[model samples]
Target: MPAALEESAKPVIIGRSSSHFTRVTRIFAAELHVDYSFRVVRDLMSSNPEDYGGNPALKIPSLQTPRGVWFGSLNVCRELWRRSSPRPRVVWPEDHDEPLLANAQELVLQAMSTEVSLIMGKLGGTGDSAHHTKMRQSLINMMAWLEDNATSVLAALPQPRDLSYLEVTLFCLVSHLEFRDVLPTAPYPELNKFCQQFAARASIGETTFGFDT
Candidate 1:
């Protein structure tokens, strides 16, 4: 059993610490100085849908806030932002007009993350060549684009924001790639450096990587 949430204040974050999505929520909670109870759901192989009623998708990191239950990692983070007094300002420029770039970045992050997950799953038990090939090509393309454009793209971002959802999600994806040895780090030096700096954050440190039991 996990520790109970405080009655006076604080929200309950129910999820395993090992999930990347859950870690993102934990990092956000840590940044906001929000106390949360982490309900560990070890090994998805043994976890049932009933164990995650708060998130119908059966995803980890479902948050039970004072206002209501929040599903999805980013959704939970948004709720955390809302709950915080003098809410932490947006970490990315809200007025940016680079919709194409932003969308591309998000798509790449999602693709890379999905690739990592699929590959890891394959290594753990199942194996599929077509899936591996598709993920490999998608990741390769994304890395090529980032290697050729990351500096300029990042330079155009609004300063003082520190980080964005794109940045953090990308960072998590890249870190997972390395942690699982899914790909060689040499292919993405710039991304490697960005993740290194991002990982140095106190919030990130609190949510360091570990395999789910």
Candidate 2:
């Protein structure tokens, strides 16, 4: 059995609450029944050595585990999966074309996230205009392809009710996109529907959307 959630025993999550990456980790932790305490590390836009120490890339969702510090949301999730009883497996199918499709999904989601971040910066009056235009074009192109292709990709994958890292990452991306109002929600109706369904789950409900401090 996993250790109980003692005050001092909780793993420290070295990131702010509002970060989608951090939320993904938190939600996974909740699912795995891994107790954690979140520490607010603000000023993500600044390049500070201390901030980089936790996650050399200065990314959010770095975990301070008993073993040591683990970086990256996905990496932390994997660790949590390992620690959890009845370990979770990747939800994508093995026999079909799921591996490639999953890779494409992740790539598009990453691009979409970057675009939304740029758009947020622009709206906040702290972004470069040229970069914003370029990112917006890229986002639009990626979204078009995602909308046109997601159904086929999903069709190839096995249907499992339990959430996987892929689903968690995808959920965070879609929620962040909506929260930032980067794209019209109606355009990606299928993705939006998936998000709505996923959001109703206890883990997701516990990790509501917000911008990190």
Candidate 3:
């Protein structure tokens, strides 16, 4: 994490600063003390694949690295973990063998994806469309489920661990809802409390969501 070392031959992280998926990988990189140069993808609606670092899926978070392009936040985060010396103990999605843990991970990811669809729909001027309405309901259902189960989910996470993908993704999802103004989260007291506690991390502060410019 030395200043000189951080500036040396860093990988390029291609994504918009406001993306939740992008923030997820950035948080992981920070936690692992991995340095990388950020390349802003200025246009989210760009049809060209090159606009998103040659991602065929046109996703925001594609990591251009020495090894090759790693598409998606999960792959990028895994690669970041692999590159870190003295790697910290991380609880990945695969480690959630129990029903409670597995369900939490599933709901968190699903909710994130749903939130993205809703945002895109609104930006595309389809906010009043039937599918958009369904997506809103889906997000509502998922949030209600997560909020009601937050206490048990937090208590169930494995202790003495450096970090868990579930927790990080959950934090990003909740925080992004507020950041993007996609949903009003005031009703979810449990989730709000969790976010309040998690926001104390330096990584969280460093990766605060905002427009690139």
How many clashes would you count in candidate 1? 0
Position 100, candidate 3: lDDT? 86
- Residue pairs of candidate 3 with colliding backbone atoms: none
Predicted candidate 1 versus true structure: per-residue lDDT over 1-213, tens digit per residue: 233343335677777655667777787877777767777776555447657635667666687765568887778888777666666655642345687457546665566567646766685765567766677777777777776776676676666774466676667777766676666768788878887787788988888888656
TM-score of each: 0.81, 0.81, 0.94
Candidate 2 structure, TM-score to reference? 0.81
Candidate lDDT scores, in order, read 0.68, 0.69, 0.91
* Model 3 Cα shift for residue 75 (angstroms): 0.5
lDDT of 2 by residue, 1-213 (tens): 243433235577777666677888888988887777777787767577467335667666687766778887777877776677776545532233555576655665576468547765776896768877777777777766666766676565556635566567667777777676776668888878778887888898888877654
Candidate 3 per-residue lDDT, tens place, 165-213, comes to 9889999999999889999999999999999999999999899999978
The candidate that achieves the highest lDDT relative to the unseen native structure: 3
TM-score of 1: 0.81
lDDT measured at residue 158 in model 3 versus the true structure, 0 to 100: 83
Pairs in steric clash, model 1:
none
